[model samples]
Target: MSGKDKPKSAPDVPGATKAVRKLGDELAEARQLHRLLVDPLLNTVRAERLRVSVTRSLWFFLACGLGFTTAGVQAFLADGYTTADPQWWAAWLVEPAFAGILITLLRWEAEMLARRLEVTAAVVRKLKRLLLFSTLVMNVIPTVRPPDGHSFNLGNLFVHIVIPLIVFFLAEVMPVVQEMCTRAKDTATVPAAPDVDLDQQTDEPPADIVRPAVAPVVPSVKLPPTVMTQVRTTLDSVRSEGRTPNVADIAKVVALPDNLARQLLADLTPVNGHTVPNI
Candidate 1:
């Protein structure tokens, strides 16, 4: 078996060529799918969800930071063993540390808004309630007792315990009460959009002319398809004619009450064929 007997290193096998061809086909199929599929809307929704989630997480973190800052400040204020010459830097540092937490939260909140997320509205409401409760407690409790003469009695009912409880109640419970009131009003007040008079805009025109039509102010009454289609046509007519359509015309087309027609129109007009902001 000399060099000649080795016989030209066995002419590149058929199985190897077939395997390469199969691999190429699979790769082409993958690329074809990559080209044909569209995912921008799904990606957009996912991005929005992620933005809201991150905003919530940042607030939760800030809440934790607030707890730590409160504790740290309490300690600094209550430490009784003072130097003959007080440490001005350590005393000054406490104020700056609280300021840093506030500044970071402000920046993060700004970023959250830039993302077009509505998280700040809810957070602001909560913060206001907390501030109110804290102010109320500070007024009621003239002085906070210091524990061990080295730390403030943040654990006591009058300062830490009772104030936090009030804040929690205002932030959490008051919103529920407000929502219930809103929903109750909606139940009584909601009427069909077709019944709405476009000629008489609401108490005020929406801030943005092109703003999506407001959701129906009323709730609870669901319209059938025939009624909904009629409402859309009526709106198109109203917009085209530059005058509100007659109640009789709407009744003839959809057999709906005038109020119901108006409500339906209100809900569907500006938002026709478009998604509006959730808030």
Candidate 2:
């Protein structure tokens, strides 16, 4: 076959190559955006939701356990008394009263701990212990005595002992959980500082003139007439006192922030033998 008769290779399409390169660049940007912005936001929201869910679950379980334990205590107290007796009815109120006080104290402690405060009062500790001991005694005494003719119930005794202790420990640990969840939520919700790309920075001097950092001024807002008058009066007084008008003098007189005072002084003062227009 002649060399000229052989099929020639297809020429490279510049447009196809450029389009592929553009698509790759866009994909890379999307990935970068996800990593730098979207992912962190999603993770923070997820963490906040998890904390809320766990906190609610803890409270739900605590309520259920406390309700059951209160019922047990009521049963123990009312065991020997007949339903017709007023004492049997009064027994129901006894455990609930103690439990209510204990719960109130625990809630107070949780609030204090969540605020990073300590409940260091000796009375608080003593009172909490007293309430817990009272419930334990009421619950356990019935199990050991077993109402005369009945045999001692080891299972009843075990439950009565374990449940009260569990309640006590739950009361103790819940405050710590509240504190942790509050702190974690606060940390997650805080805006993160943008990550700086050190590699993109250069040592080369900028072509534009560098200016000293100043507080940004909003164009839509102007200084009040009263404030402008006060500033002008203060400036005149400072000049009369044989002192050069400055930011400190203006700030002291007008109670303005240093940056605002500085901006005001610049605006009101004459420059290069020219009078500045009133603002």
Candidate 3:
């Protein structure tokens, strides 16, 4: 039939429109949950970000510390360490320096304790937003005329405003901060799957399919008491670190030379719920 002769399409029916809206809502909800899983705000990401926020935002912390320390240094330089001029370093630390020192110590402690990867992600996100708005307001400060008809100096512009703006941008690049942005974007999107042709069968097996097999049982192998204790300790350590205990860790635990440890591991069928290496 000619194109013109084809039947004209009908307008949307009430039932079909309702179905479409329902589908869209469901899709939106699914996308929200998917994004939450992909990028949680208060999980390990937050902990990690919190841990690095001080170090990553170094310039801000350093400046604050210096401002506080400057007064003390100046006092020391004034000379004459009498009762009036105390030389105590601790006494010299002021409010600004105290904040910096506290933050530095916290960050250092977290690092030693195995810092979280995104401990400061949320904080950075919020701070970056606040700083961006503040920058806009502050840049206008120099342009405003005083009652005496003189404009303020923006001579310290780069040091005070520009550098901070740059730091805010830098903070946004952190892994946790990026995750929050992605999470926001993801929630706004609808979940969608690619069109699939069910009738089109592929020659290859599905990736998720598992094939079971029967194997001959091997005789049990036993290790000496000392070796068993060492193996247990190594496995425990590996588990605590959230990893599977492999050949290397086992060797370290038992203090067995590499060749012997490897041979012993191979001989065992399974140890402490894990299969021996090379089995």
Candidate 4:
């Protein structure tokens, strides 16, 4: 209860408070720099990596489910056959063969859907259903009616039924998942379009100085008076129709080069207090 019994307060080291303040300031600055520079790069990498991880995880689980279903189908097909029989060996391949076709079709469908194509052919739908139904029927038959007078197994039946359905649904849903992931990855990776200010655009030049009568033309060559007159006539006709005479319009009417047409337009139109230079 005396002062000696009380623990001494920790001594304050010189500049400890200032050191802490300096450390906090440095950390704040580092965070700001990280956000400004490192975060964008990390975010892009993370998005692509995350998408790949998700796709791989889906495939891994689907593979496990399919393997389990294939084992069930193998058992059902090999039930009455001896190990030495060729039919017994062949039974192992049935589910995988069906699964291979299903995977191929689903992959093709996924690629097509990712590219925004429709896959509405009745044959494709029928074929997919047929494969799934065949696998389901094969997988569940042995469990539902056990051979050798063995009692029917509820556990085996449950597994046989549920695993095949899971495989079928996984097959059906993988394409959709792939399409969504592809779209999301594309959206994240595509660079944004640069912003434009439409108000700054104008048909007229910014200054009073006249542009060349025909850009990049040899000074030695000049348009004949008849050609100039024809250009003027075309411009007048365009104005009469209540349409602005642009380079394209002038070129179409007079069969002039685009550069010459643009120059001709500039020469023909008067800007503020500026005289048109003779071509």
For residue 242, give model 2's deviation from the true position in Å.
48
Q: In candidate 4, which residue pairs get closer than 3 Å at backbone N, Cα or C atoms, i.e. clash?
A: none
TM-scores of the models, in the order given: 0.25, 0.55, 0.27, 0.54
**What digit string (tens of lDDT, one per residue) describes model 4 on residues 120-228?**
8999989988988888898889888887878988998998888878878887787777666544443333222233334466887669646676763422213445445
Residue 244's lDDT within candidate 3 is 60
For model 4, the run of ten residues with the poorest summed lDDT? 187-196
Indicate the TM-score of model 4. 0.54
Question: Any idea how many clashes model 4 has?
Answer: 0
How many steric overlaps does candidate 2 have? 0
How many Å off is the CA of 270 in candidate 3?
Answer: 4.4
- lDDT string for model 3 (142-211, tens) is 3342224555555543344454454344433344343443333322232223333434667764798544
Tens digits of per-residue lDDT, candidate 1, 175-261, equal 333333322323323232233333467876667644447653454345444344655566567768887555555554444446665
lDDT of 4: 0.69
- Looking at model 3, residue 39 earns an lDDT score of 44
Instruction: List, residue by residue over 119-206, the lDDT tens digit for candidate 2.
Output: 7899998998898888888888878887768898899899889888887777777776766654454334333444444445678635
Per-structure clash totals for the candidates = 18, 0, 12, 0
